[model samples]
Target chain A: MAEVTFDKVRKAFGSAVAVRELDLAIRSGEFVSLLGPSGCGKTTTLRMLAGLETPTSGAISIDGTVVNELAPAKRDIAMVFQSYALYPHMSVAQNIAYPLKKRGVSRADRDVRVAAVAATLQLGALLDRKPRQLSGGQQQRVALGRALVRDPRVFLLDEPLSNLDAKLRAHMRAELIELHRRIGKTMVYVTHDQLEAMTMSDRIAVMHDGVLQQFGTPKEVYETPANLFVASFIGSPGMNLVKGELRAAGSGLAFVRGDLSLPVANGGTAGAAVTLGVRPEDITLGAGPFACTIRVVEPTGHETIVMAEAAGETLVARAAPDSQLVPGQVVPFAVRAQRLHAFDADGRRLPLVFAQSNGA
Target chain B: MRNRSLTSRILLNVLAWSIVFVIAFPLVWMILTSVKPQFELFRIPPTILPQEVTFEHYHRVLVETPFLKYFRNSVILAVGTTVLVIVIATLGAHSLVRFSYPGRERLAQLVLFTYLLPSVVLIIPLYLLMVWLGIANTLFSLMLAYTTFALPFALWLLRSFMQGIPQDLEAAALVDGASRMEAFVDVILPQAVPGIISTALFTFILAWNEYLYALVLVNTDEARPLTTGVMNMLITAFNIEWSLLMAASVMMSLPVIIVFALLQKHLTRGFGAGGVKG
Candidate 1:
């Protein structure tokens, strides 16, 4: 296992930049996921690291060794493609043993190693079967087995769970985590799904428009996001932002959001226009400072997401499923004072105090 | 889902058989005519069935004349052309379809143009070139001419088949410690059996049926192929044997028919595989 480090790596396709200046250091034996929207350069970054794509500038090193010009085969990395690119003409045994044979392993040992890997993948009975005879999930297992047999220094996965069904994806996600734990090899996985990143990564690297937005553990990213993009992109029902002018109302201050004014817990400054950000679950639906018009109610078994409008801004409030509410009804919601986040005009978070400023 | 009436079902069966018979009539006529007596062969009213049949024509064609020499020459040329066309076309098509290079579009279009219209106009220029190379009227010249006509068709057909394979299969091989060429030979080409077989059979049949080039290029009977050999039998003395010529014609067509029947499965698979992709 080796730590992979990218030093200002950049990749461009002709004039179009697929990945702009990117720098990340993944610790040895840690699972890191590059998560972003489609066309956001997550796959490009993974391909660059695997040597499938050449970087336009900067260098990628493994274990403090420069490998910017190394070919993929010489780099000693095994990659599992999203399509599960198994050899259609070969049986499962031959497919899994391909790398070993290339490396000049003994004939008897290759067969034995293939058998053992097959048993681990629950593919003992499918050794003689061609790829066409196997189902999609089985084919994926065979693909994984082929990569695992080589025992390369690093394992690169490019959205490997995408081709499977929903339940199979979840099952494979857990199995991949367990496999990584058992083998304890350094791995870099790429996916667009945030849940896949949060579930399987030691550290999730969130990207946007070819730039790294945030790189931290899931807890750090969820609780204290670096910017507006990371805060909005990582959550399912994303954090809400109510734009308003910051003013001193009571002992501390309050956000004056048009006709609806709400008190801020630790707010400051009377002149700067800032945004009040809070999670939907942080807003209670019973009584509070501002009144909102309920537009739609969506119950997702555990919590109901109530779409509401206040001060010409669309908002969503999460409540317990037991709350009896309907569309077009007026509702009052309160925030947990201390749970408020204030951002300046440039979308940078600002730390404000409760008793610092009085009235404007 | 279906409880069809017996009359309509029988009518459909009869229609199917009629189409089959229409397709297979030429071979039956050739074979039956080859064994007929001389009086029945050119009867005023063509007879479908003859009262008497004999192997006298087969014996004459096999023993007398230079028919055996023509058979040997045709076999060598056809087989040689088939092998050459399949190998060269496969490599050329794979290079065009799999890799990136300058002028690939122009080269691909050239192959398509040649395939869509097999160029018989090149015959005169090629005939002069063959004579200039001091190989005219030789079996080697016939082989060269046959391969030229056969290769463009093989290249275009195999290219369509190669385009259908997923490129990720080769990419996986490259990352798994094989060079790009090794990946193609080991991982990609094995799955292209259906394409290779079809290209070979197509080249074989084209060279077998080609008559214009053979008629104009070859002169002496020693280096003559079967197509020209059959025509040479028509020119003789007043007592020219008609049954012997028909037997030789039937013999000329036997290999073509057998090859078609055996390779029809692979040819159908090749065409069917393409319909589902691209």
Candidate 2:
């Protein structure tokens, strides 16, 4: 029920800065993810929020009270580590009841509450079993049960699903979403997985090199990434970025390369170096103004990811599974006019204005 | 492959049994000698089995000497030193592993450095300290000296073991509303049981078999452990009672063997997983 605020937070380890100049505001009951590659300072930020690591500078407040010096025990936050980190010596019931017992709940109350949580997690049959005796998914549930039983002000999860198998991870992702909806706790999840962040978080804070690149809704961050890094990192197969130059055509502007010219709603200095960004799904194959030689065709049961080469740069486009794309076949390609994202040589996004449709 | 495996297995068994026999021969001979009469003991090539068993040496050790009193003193010294060393070492190792303070790494290195020093070099300073404390020739001096001698090694061993325990368990405890101290007692301490058991065993054995300090610090049988007291039996100017000496050695070793046998299971138990997937 508490909103978390990080005001210019920074963390450093012997001058090797792990996280720096992070100013983030997480709304009450909102699920926010600090998503980035490893060593991108997502875990450091989460640790700072968990009171495990103190900010080298700046203030961190929870529900309007500054917790700069508050110990983790006093912070009323529960975290599920990348490793579930269940107490190996305790039984499943004892593991779940740990937080309540620590809070000085009596034996009778502890048992009742633990039993209820176990039932909620479908772990009633495993109350007496040790953690090692449980399967990976079951152990994950016990870890979740431990955090859920506390009903803490905030829940921080650090790559909780990265260990599970693919099917279990997908199942757990849905369960986590339902759990967040049910509990409505302010959860700040840290992971290198963009899919996890995109699917689960109300707001995704994409970070790189210890800096927040973009923090917005999944749709906003995916559809309108802030920079080259965000644009390439947010989507599957990533956004195709081709280094080229913007040129004034007849009436509007066109992104020009060697043999391909894309109509873009563009505004950049003429003949200046630019990077053209577009999503795979936004490009239509089989009918366009320019021809592209297909290099690879990957049909993943439902959708096809066709890697096509044009202007000496390969671009991946998502098409229908039955598109029957083949290698060495030159196909016509046309990108949606408004879907074009142009970045200058400095890798900053350039504002694009809609141009007339030049291809049918 | 199966035939080759069986051949290798037989070779291993033969090697293992031969090594065991080599190690156990002395203990077996001592036990046999303890029950043998003096005539049989002094015979040519020494009788492998006792010709006639006798309880005379056992009776003399129990009634004619201060053997029981020396045993009691040894028990008190060993147990007291072991308890003290374990408590101090566990706390020291936990702090070294978990807390980050100035010179913490240097201090941890110092623990191993101290253990590397020979006990003979430290005996003079330890004896002088005991005399300064006015506790010379008392069981307290021996206990204190044994604790100091064993503390460094115990700290080093326990520290290595404690480092293997993931800090996440304690962090989980902290987030669950337990104080740092509470988390240590409830989580960390319980996980370190095998380490504590090993340190206790090592320190107890070091104190139990310690001869130099016991000989230098304590003269009277009232405060002497078995190592010094058993050696005193040999320095007599008369006929050396080989049976009595062997019997005393066997009795002194029985407790250590029993303690090791009882706790050996825990020493090998694999709780290293901690249920955490890397």
Candidate 2 residues A163-221, lDDT tens each? 99999999999999999999888999999999999999999999999999999999999
- Complex DockQ, candidate 2: 0.81
Interface RMSD of each: 0.9, 0.6
Off by over 4 Å in 2: A250-253, A262-266, A357-360, B1-23, B37-48, B268-278
Candidate 1 Cα RMSD (Å):
3.6
The lDDT for every candidate, in the order shown, is 0.85, 0.88
lDDT of 2 by residue, B1-278 (tens): 99999999999999999999999999999899888887888788767888898888888888888889889999999999998998898899999989988899999888778878888998888889988999988999988888887888888777878888888999899989999889999999998898788778888888888889888888887788888887796458876878899888888899999998998877555233322223
Kindly report the docking quality category of candidate 2.
high
Task: Return the number of clashes found in candidate 2.
Answer: 0
Best by lDDT: 2
Q: How well is candidate 1 docked (DockQ)?
A: 0.65
